[model samples]
Target: MKQPHKLWLRSLLIAAAVSVLTIVLNTLNVFEIFENKTYDLRMANSAKYKLPCDEICLVCVDQESIDWAKENYNWSWPWPREAYARIIDFISAGNPKSLAFDILYTEPSVYGTEDDTALGDAEARSKKVIQTFFISENDYDEPLFPVEQIKENAAILGNITSKKDSDDVIRRARLNYEYNGTVYPALGLAPICLTEESIDYDSIPVLEDGTVLLRFTKSIDDYLPYSAKDIFESYEAWKNGEEGPLSPEDFEDLYVFTAYYAPGLFDICSTPISQVYPGVGIHMTNLDNYLTGTYIKKIPGYVNIIWLVVLALFAALIVALSETCFTRYAAVAIPAGLSGGLVLSIAVPVILFNFGYWILLIAPLSAFIISSLVNIIFSLGAEGKQKRFIRSAFSQCLSKDVVNQIIDDSSSFTLGGKKFEMSAIFTDIQKFSAFSELLSAGELGCFLNFYLTKMSDIIIDEKGTIDKYEGDAIVALVGAPLKMYDHAKHACAAAVKMKKAELELNKDIVNYASNPKPSWMEDELYSAFKILVANNKTIFTRIGINSGEMIAGYFGSEKKKNYTMMGNNVNLASRLEGVNKQYHTNGILISQATRNLLDDDFVVRSLDKVRVVNINTPVQLYEVLDEKSCAKEELIAYASDWEKAMSFFTSRDYQSAKIALSELLKKNPSDGVAEYYIHLLDDYFLKGTYPQEKDNEGVAFNTEDGVFKLLQK
Candidate 1:
């Protein structure tokens, strides 16, 4: 090789060595810095996966279930003891092996205070949750457990927990735990072995190293594994009419394995459902699957690693194909196939074969596999026609990764792109035209470039892909490039950070006369730039976010084109940015789509229904909180009240709407959205088109005649 080539090779070798060292150090740090995660795995199995044996599940005592039991038993209060007793009796009747209760008797009982010892004694014995299993290590390095009364009656499952990873929340429960000189099975295992002859701890299949293959069983045709409530409710509804709850038969043979499924009530939370499961219903589903021979997808560690690498390769291929073929169709089809293949791979083996597995392909894998396939095809000259489509589909909204994901997956690359769900963000510097006139071209270029760079950086940093840069605006996407785990969160983060950066930039410029007093000089410069005009200089930008289905990908004329998204959702996103001004807010306005996807991460206050130029119907609007200190409950209450008032105003229920608005103002004295809508409501109810009647939903109606009229059909 030439000297240059030799030197480059040497440098690459050195870099690789350094990278390896860095990776090793990072892995070690990951172990040391994070919480221990062994128990998390156990919890995960308990929540989602089924044990080898049947009959291990948590019967959810939902409000509906409780209500049904109460009416029949003439009971006024919800009690865990009665349920426990019923479960115990049922288990005894079934004459199956073991029984475990995933509950904790952490506190003393209140039922003991009653005269009838039946209620009190039952409550006390219900603490026999310990009866379900043996306890895990109470002291470190020593496998230890105490055999108590319940342990004698049924195989007690010690619902023990270990520390979690510091950076994440995953606990891997130890299988075949050892305590002192004794080895004990997990409560789940213990119960199964005791109840059925099919499972013998000593005889069960095990790896050469003694570990049984643990896996998830999933099926596409089946919904998320059903909880006890689903079946019980169905049965109950069949017996009780439409407005009914569970019936007596619903409780028959209801061998309940009670545990937490409710957020505040349950002990486990790692299911695909909410971080805090609503009830322990997952346990019941798991038990049902365990008994009936249901399973999901699983990939062993070594093989999973291989798949991960393959997917990465696929992702790389997608990028190449997109650049080469330049067609949207190829990009789209590839990813679709990969995602489908992965789902199928996971479903078929577990659901059909009665084995366990997991769709080992991570989000990135699906993104890469499909994108690579299509992009490869599109890159070919014959298919390069999709190039214009590529630009059109993603130019203004997606990040490079998302673009690459689209390129990698033929499914995402389409000339006439199909509708897919995505989160769109539109940001515009308010009054940019006026701001530009105030400065020379050089000054304006510097000003615009600086703002755009900062905002775009923020967006990219928050995992958003920049779609394009319009004169005074920038549009981007969060879910595309790859459907992110938390696109809304990333979008919200970008909006907040961009606004923050603007304020800091202005602070330094405020004292510099040569800088010509940064036009967006409001307290929150970035957010106030176009909207916060100061001394005829407010060039603040407004941001709006809407997440929903939109026709995305490259679609345009061959000669002149770009990648972009076009649809009602995208339009709504653009409309929302301006909506901040109407609502007199500084940050993002979210749609219902955005709301449904969120859990506890956001604090949003509702704004009035927007009467945009072309849209006839009003949409619910919200102002997302930038700080955690913002009271979520109070904000929700206030916003809900305002929305109620808006409803009254829409229906021309002037009196009711006014009352609601006035009530909201009482809670939040300077609420801007409410105030503006209140004025509009008066005029709308009195003069605009709406029925003058007060009902539960006080609403005023207005008809739009412009661009919005076209959408009515």
Candidate 2:
């Protein structure tokens, strides 16, 4: 199959896997418990609500109040009903907004009819006083109101049953419950109804199940509290004209909740804010929420489903995009994907919360996390495949550094072309056909393999890309698949090294043929081959280098592919290698384009300017003499005189140019560059008109283009 189709299929599979996992997790409702915990965390992190600290109060029958009452009034457990009657009368004088009793009075007082009469009379004088009742589900199914004597005098009766979650935490409350065809409001609902008598029942916000998510205004510690005995004691003190420890005026205009808070009392319940909270405090907060309309309305089930789908798709999209585009940068993208997904997971819910929408935090967070992991796994697998392919393709020819670059970013090594600036190196065995004629096919193969392996190693050591080998020639590229700023220098360096390696290989061949035969050589006829090598029947190669923008990528038929480079720039490098024969020069030849990018460390001499076959303009070429193979003093002197001769030749000074070349040829008798220049001078001198050396306008010595325009191949 085509590579593009395969990539798309992989991406689709990754998206599908993530989507399925998210759907399965959501279906199982596994994230609900985690979501609840996150809700608690957000609530804990949130700023406390600005509840009216003085608006509502809890008058507790705490142990402190019990002890105070016991010491002063000889009251112990089951105190007389007159004790509650005196406390009620004290608070009633202040005309509080609303008062609710969380304590139950299931039966008449055990003291007597007089004690019952006293408590009932105290209730009659109070305004907006509510008594707690139970909604019994027994066979009778009735509202279990307070005793008949106290019920007739009470202003209102409310159900006090608090609904608990499966976790045993009271997070929500029912607005009302029905018994015997009559709807009884909760202990909190009575105060709201009493305060907003003009509001319609249908106008209030309530769930379809007649419930609401309770909005906790404050912690249990923030609730205002007064002792039961303090109220009665303070009222007595004020009536006697002395300063009171507490007074009825303290309860004026506040919605008060009265309940038992002794440690042994069976009224503490777990809430989101506290593990052990007094039920009276819960009622107090509920009533305050109602009065201020702070009740939270939960989103409907349909909205939750849609939200889950949207979040899942969002997570899947991120995974797919990250996998397809950023596969090369897995090291960077993996962590970024994880962190970005996690941030959005948290931020989305928190943002919605500010707008009064409480989204499921953990479920969406799980979707993001699970999706990211799936994509990262797929990406890692794809990256591993790419690295393996790169190792297979380039490991034999390139250095570890170059190979590592491909491993680090496999996307750069895709099966397609990319245009980038690079340097090309081409090398060919001089007179290869003649050499092949002298050896058997197997001998030729062994020799070629040895020669090619040595030259390829030199190129790779300098970080060049080996494009291919054509019979007796090798083509290589630099600055491709991975960028290298000094590609020209590396190409030039490799060419010089290859020339040196060729000499070493020649020595090794001669040494091998002269000494005892190595164990690897199974042929007894190999001794006969040694005679040809010792006679200086050696191999020579010429190298060419050029630098420019070229196209490098995979090339071949459907069943095969080879990573190679191709362009006009590459052709010029090949031409330069062939141009060496015209001047009898060997070693390395480089175009002016390559020479211009080199540092001063290289020893190079200008050869000539010639237009090769199929190219329009003349190109300046240079011979890169191996300094490591030559005497330093001789190389320096030769380069200096050669530059002077070329300058004189281009300036139309034939005599001076001939003098310089003749002197240079005397010092280095085998200098091809000097021989070629002197031959040019000889040809011009014999033509008698000094060759005119002009353009079509007959201008003298027009060497502005600095090219010789070779007439011979």
Candidate 3:
């Protein structure tokens, strides 16, 4: 085979694989939302196409009709069955081709048996009336049909249930429903069966599942329905030989569909064309589609695969046959061309849709996108020498994600700063200086690597950007390079996970102490290590998160600049990590800005209001409880008492808060957070000051705002 043929084969294989995956995802309903929206857009854009154009009309039991009935007949809704009898009489006089009542009379009328008999007589008089049946969820094999008298007198009984897609949008019209081993036509199908249309009932192209892709056109405004009140007036006028808004001529050979449209009485469904669409209008649209023979049908699974492969091969051939100049310009012109072509592929479904067929949207589009990306990758490989040099230079300094991002689009990265809302997390080991003395320099380096690696994995897994690693600390940001709406939530979750991870890492260290030392280790060194392990001396880290607008970019000389964040918001996050020390807490602490972004699923409790050094504005802090460390029951009880104590403290009732904290300490004696607040209360009441601190940055409890101000860092 020629080189072009090989390229085509490769492209075909890639498309086939992606197409199959798309099919699997689609079957699992992963694309249901996107597909429904796409269908709605198509319906809104398509030209208005009417079926039985001159024959079909809707007689809605609108609010006006209901009010008219109440005043004229001296009765409210659930009106006597005789009222429908009169409607039947009026519509029957017009000699319509089919009169479908999209209503169900499943029980005897409240008026009397006489009213039921009267309605039954009228239904019998109209040879074209189609009654509706409801398929109850409790039993699909046996349908809930209209009352026996009405059913026996009707021309045909049809199912009224239109199955909605998973997204609650009705995109398919059920053609028929089977009950007790007998298949019955649907409400929409009933009219087609009764009309003089040229459809072969036995051989229509209905799916084996008895459904057809519902093709909607324009909007309900396109088919202006005649009001039921107007039709009743016309009937009275015709009887009295007087002129009215409606005439018998309007109903000649018409397929009239009557349904209640009074809000709370009629079924309101969501559709592509309209969010709150009337269910009756949907049935009318389905009926119209059937009359015009324009119902959409799905392309078979195998046929979809074939279409994908053919399109992919064609695209690949276009690229492979390109001359050297085309390949040289492929970097710019080819991508632009491919983008335009991908957009144009949308027209395939749109055009084929007119012919009553639907092509899987995601499959072809995925093939186009993936194939283009593959071709670019292959082209890069063809220029391996230069590309490798670029990758090697950037790979060392930047993360793999940032490197790939720059490689893909270098213009996105710039030295100029950009301002955006982001969530920043700052973490620090509780006592890093002590770790240096505990471990030799080499062991400390290895330990730090292990800790950082575990923390980095959690951040990256949450799609957070690792800003930089300060010694014994990790600084990360969410919502950069790629925007995330829930950046704050992600950052907070990452903080919680890091705290949990530290606990697990410490446990691993304790477990590892049992392992034998290296042959080079002397007895004294081994004994010292064993003693450290026996004492359960392990690292504890504190995390803090804050969310606010920040400026992010490189800041340094051109040769040595590093990409990171710098702003008041970023500093607040750093301060929060340090504030954990003041609380004597070794867990995650989040500023109010971050707390506001958290959903109800996170377990957190308000810690305090504090003014960190250099920032006069008071920030509210919350402690995010670890799901593993704290039992749910204990956390709930602790949070209740903790909140009560803080409430008293905030109101300047130090004695009450003291009593509350002391009571809480009885149950939760090991809670450092509670003990820390008690100590503050004791010092303020006795010494007239907080624990010893720098003069300018002295920790002072403010009575006016109930905020603890730290005057020094």
Candidate 4:
């Protein structure tokens, strides 16, 4: 198959693998516990916008009620069933829609059978009252029902039994419970079942385990609790025809759920809103959800798996397609895909929660993350292998910057050319041929390698690309594969540093005789070294730098290509390296074009304008003396005085120029440029070569075929 098709197939395979893994984990309930926690967090965050259910309220049997009972009626912990009867009668007076007891009365009242009958009688009179029943297990063949006395007198019996998740949080309620073939509605659902005839029971969303996810709209604290003792007291006040703190109108048309709120009752459990939530609040939340049609509907496992597969495939395709493109695109697409997928993974489920649906977040999120990571790892492995190959193949032939550029974008390796304003450096060792002939081939090779390595290191350090080496000359270019705006500055800096390094290398050579010679040293090599030492001469390098528009790219045959620069400016740089011999100036020189691009970081003295061979345009030249930071005071003073002398000579003021040159030579007798100019003035007087009339144009010389030609105007 084609590469694109193969990549697409690979991405599909990765998506499939991730989806299947997540599905298996989902089936095994691996993410169930954590998924439940995320669901709770969504519920809690969503609760901030949900208003509390005003239609449903709690009548709590709190400690105050218990203490009041003890003080008023001398009742202990278990109040008489008659007390509950009185409370029921008081609530029924207001004609509430329904009243459900969260408290379970599965056993007969401890006071007597008549006490149970009294409570049951009050429930019968109320006619809207609902009692609770409990079952330890759901799959029991036979389950014990509530006591006969209470069961027969109550209006309806709801299963108050609820289950907690693994995290011990009650987030779902079993709306219906089956016992020995009889299906009973939950206590929270019993009131809704009796009152709301319009609700389709089958339409209610439920999990496979037959439980409805309860969307808690409010906390237990949101409910204003009505004390049982206070209700009893209100009942007495109504009987005496006097005003009371609470009236029958308070409970009118409201669903009153009564349960224990006292901490000692141990009826609190962990809920999404609070760790210690009243158990009775769960039933109230269930009723609130059902009444408002806001109960959370869990999305089916199949639907979740579909979403997971889609998201995983999306992530996989993003990585695969990006990898198929240039590596630069892959670098951006991978992170964007990972972050975008993660955000979507989280947002989908939370958004669904607002619409009363609970889509599984972990399965889809895990699929996206795992699939993206796997594809990214594979892509990196492939790219890494390709990069290693490229680096190995070209690291020695090209600069590190060029090799890296090719690695990042392989198109750079192709044979192409583009013109850019850049700098080129041509370096040659002075008198290298003479010294090389005196040593063996091995000794010559060692010396050249050492010198080339030191200079090459400085070039690379300054971000210059080594073009090639011709015998003992180094040709390099700056700002090609990687464009730098300060190419001229960097090229000049490399030249300066190379000069400094050469001085250090010469010192090493001068001190070589002091150290013990190697056992393998040849007598001829030692003799040549002694000759150099006797003459007090060290190897010097000449560097020429020029900056202009040059065509830089890979050139040569298709089979064997080389990256180099070619233009008139490149020729000029080579010509300037040889120009150092004309005036016997220092080792470094630059063209006027190059000098224009340089900052004040370097100190250079102006040389005469010269027309190089094969180039008709006369270009002015400057000799680089030393970096300003390291240039000696005498050298700075000499350069300044030399500039004044050149200015006088350029204006045809021969007398002033001769006097200035003489004075400069006296100060620094060994200054070759000053002595050369002094001799030039004497030669000009003898030959009458001086210009007859003053001209704005300076004295121009020609280096025709590597020989200097004196100019006469």
TM-score of each: 0.37, 0.50, 0.53, 0.51
Candidate 3 or 4, higher lDDT?
Answer: 4
RMSDs, each prediction?
A: 21.8, 42.5, 25.1, 39.7
In Å, residue 319's CA in model 3 sits off its true spot by 4.5
- Candidate 1: list runs displaced more than 4 Å: 1-59, 65-83, 94-98, 113-155, 160-176, 196-255, 260-264, 273-355, 358-713
What does candidate 4's lDDT look like per residue over 1-713, in tens digits?
Answer: 22777777888998999899989988998767557657777888788777767889889888778889999999987788888888789899999988888876756777888999898889889988888877765365445566787688777778877678875678899887877677788888888766776346676776788788888865776765798878988999988888788998899999998888763363656787775587788788878877777788878768888899999998888777676764465555555656677678888888888777889876787788678656655554577775764465346545799778866775454344689889999998886756665666766666677679999999999999999887679999998877888998889889989988988988877776556666776554555556567666687898999999998876532223467777778878987887776677768889898899888877888977766654667778898877788888888888898899889977667789999999988887878878877776786643556422122122343223322332211
Which pairs in model 4 have colliding backbones?
Answer: none
Residue 126's C-alpha lDDT in candidate 1?
40
lDDT leader: 4
Candidate 1 residue 395 Cα shift, in angstroms, is 10
- What's the CA error at residue 389 for candidate 4, in Å? 16
Error of 4 at 241 (Å): 1.1
Candidate 2 residue lDDT tens string, 499-552: 878888888888888888888874533643574574557778878889988888
Error of 3 at 421 (Å): 20
Global lDDT of each candidate: 0.49, 0.69, 0.71, 0.76
Best by TM-score: 3
Put the candidates in lDDT order, highest first.
Answer: 4, 3, 2, 1
Model with the higher TM-score, candidate 2 or 4: 4
Q: Clash pairs of candidate 2? A: none
* Candidate 1, lDDT over the whole model: 0.49
